[model samples]
Target: MKTFTIKDNVKKFLTVLFWILIWQVVSLFTEEILFVSPFKVLPKIFENLGDLNFYQNLLSTVLKVSWGFILGLIAALFLGGLSYRFKVFQELISPLILFLKSVPVVSFIMLAWLFLSPQGIPVLISFIIVVPIVYLNFYEGLSRVDKSYLNMAEVFNVGLWKKVEYIYLPSVRGYLLSAVELSIGMAWKSGLAAEVITFPEFGLGALIYNSKLYLDTVNLFAYTIMAVVSCYILEKGVLYIIRRILK
Candidate 1:
């Protein structure tokens, strides 16, 4: 076990080092102000880390996106349940889900900006991106439930809670987690994109736009890194909480 762990760590370290080396070589060859080295960007990111406004912006964006994600998840679960119980609801909403899936993100951002306050745009965008994903995954999960277990439940006259706990939940766990992971990334991306277009007061998207306007490549890269890291941390944290609860 120790040997395997050590080997895995070594492999990951080597992989990261290889990519860093490639980046360094590319930066050296380009010698462009727009493509600053990773070292330069790292310091800028650290400097920004000290700013109070940075945390405020990060927290605000997180709150908006998280709220949106939660709302969408609940709606999806409710709607998916309804769809599972009734063929009529499923047929009615199928086209709407398809339309949401087909529409462009920028179009949604633009349309939402016209109707929603700047602060609301991110939440709306996050919801738009997350809903269809959760709906589809949950619907599939419901459809894939073992008929044998359902039949057994019916035969035994299982209560709603028991059926949910022992049958539906266990069957849907994988789908729920998978949808959540995918939606986390999508929510962040769509939310930030909406913020950038709307120029929300305190958002990572606004920071990135400002950086670009001034041609601050280092800060641009730093903000991009921060956004990616934030998304990753949120995704892992949510997944951990879900796993703990389910366990």
Candidate 2:
């Protein structure tokens, strides 16, 4: 197993190197006209890594998106539980869920801009993108839970909190985990899109947009790399927290 794992890691590294080689070749041809070489981009990334401002921008975006994610997740679980218990509420909410699912995220950002502060736009957009996904995912999981276990609990007069703790959470754990994983990525994407459009005083998106305005390709790519890396790290961190909580 250890040998296989080492070989797997090597293969992944080689695959990444292959893509970087391709990017370098492409950059050689286009660097004069558009984006710069990976060598330049990499140095820009490191330069930013040493800057206090980069950390502040990253923290700003992370905190905004994290708040949106937590709010959306809590709202989804609460509403989903209510929906599971009441058929009428589910039926009433179906249209709203469908509407949220159907609307383009760009449209949400544009409309939200008219009323919400620039700082609030990303949060709203992220929340909008997250709610339907987690709600529907959790609802499906709840609907498919084993009725026998629930009935047995009811017969024994299990307390509401105990029933949720022992039965519902365990049964829906997989689905909730999957939903959260999926939604956090979307939340980052949408939240950043909001930031780009809104151009709040601070954020990865704001820096990205400012770079574009100044035609600074190196900074643009560097900021983009930061955002992508941040998104990846945030997803892993959220999963770690969820697993610990559920355990």
Candidate 3:
């Protein structure tokens, strides 16, 4: 196990080094305004760490996206349950789910602009993006539960709580975890994309667009890095908490 871990760490290091080298080569060829070096961008990102606006925007994005994600997950589970219990509901909602799944996030953001407040846009977009993904996954998980176990439980007249404890929860745990993991990144990305277009008063996306507007390529790259790192951290943290709960 330790040897495998060392090999995996070495592979990751080499992968990152290869990308950094490519970035450095590209930056050398391009104008600073177009593509700043990763070294320069790293310092700029650290500088933002001291800036209060950074926290405010980061907090705002976090709150909005978290709210959206929770709402979407709940809605998906409720609707998925209904669909699983009644085939008609699934057939009726299939097209709508497909549309949400197929439509571009930017397109939804643009359409949403007509009615939604800039602040509300990111939240709504996140919710919209998350629902179909989690819904599909949860539905699949529920449907894929072992029918033999279910039949045996029925034959033995298993209590509702017992069935849920031994059957339903175990069956859906993987799907739920996977769904949440996938939806977290999508929700964050889609929320940020909406913020970029909407230019909300506070968000990493607003910072990114503002940096571009002012032609500050270093800060532009910095803010983009912050967004990526923050999103990745949130995904790991949420999954950790969720795994603990599911256990």
Predicted structure with the largest lDDT when compared to the true one: 3
lDDT digits (tens) for residues 1-247 of candidate 2: 9999999999999998998899899987884438588888899999999999989988999999999999999999888999999999999998999999899999999999999998999988889888999999999989988899989998999998898888888888999999999999999999999999899999989999999999999999889988998999999999999989887
Model 3 CA deviation exceeding 4 Å by range: 2-7
Name the better of 1 and 3 by lDDT: 3
Looking at model 1, the pairs that clash are none
List the RMSD of every prediction in angstroms.
Answer: 1.2, 1.3, 1.4
Cα-based TM-score, every candidate: 0.96, 0.96, 0.95
In what order do the candidates fall by TM-score, top score first? 1, 2, 3
Clashing residue pairs, backbone N/CA/C < 3 A, model 3: none
Compared with the true structure, what per-residue lDDT tens digits does model 3 show for residues 134-183? 99999999998899999999999999889878998899999999999999
Q: What is the alpha-carbon lDDT for the whole of candidate 2?
A: 0.92
